[model samples]
Target: MARVVVDVMLKPEILDPQGQAVQRALPRLGFDGIAIAEVRQGKRFELEVDGPVDDAALTRIQELADTFLANTVIEDFTVKVEPS
Candidate 1:
């Protein structure tokens, strides 16, 4: 089996309230020593393939990412096939 990973993140111009909340709470959560300039949250998807990851499979995955996984207007995504 092979593994594929897709990472989706909001565009730089978009506001990430969830990430901001975490950042704001970090200091109160005993992470005061860590200085964070900004915080952004995203999503990760792991797909298990039954066989070798070929170009066709990657192309299909890319289509899925663009159509259903990530919102093109507000987000971007990257897909990578991991070694089995």
Candidate 2:
């Protein structure tokens, strides 16, 4: 089986409203002296499969990102695949 770890992230220049929300809450929680809470909400996924790095697997992974793992318009993702 092959195990894949995927990290999904928002673009660098894009603003993260979720992060902002957390930052705003920090001050109320007595969190001070911090410049800002740049929140990058992301996902860590573990995928188990039975195959080598074939074209079909690559295409299917991309499709997975486009279809569900990421918001195509405002997010980007990177994946690390390991053989087990």
Residue 24 lDDT (model 2): 83
Candidate 1 ranges with C-alpha deviation above 4 Å: none
Please give the lDDT score for candidate 1.
0.94
User: Whose TM-score is greatest here?
Assistant: 1
Give the alpha-carbon lDDT of every model.
0.94, 0.77
lDDT per residue (tens digit) for residues 1-84 in model 1: 999999999999999999999899999999989789888999999999888889999999999999999999999999999877
Q: How far is candidate 1 from the true structure (C-alpha RMSD, Å)?
A: 0.8
lDDT of 2 by residue, 22-75 (tens): 878887998877867466666777888776857789778878977799886888
Q: With candidate 1 superimposed using the best TM-score fit, by how many Å does residue 9's alpha carbon deviate from the native?
A: 0.5
Instruction: Please provide TM-scores, in order, for all candidate models, with all chains considered together.
Output: 0.95, 0.65
lDDT of 1 at 11: 93
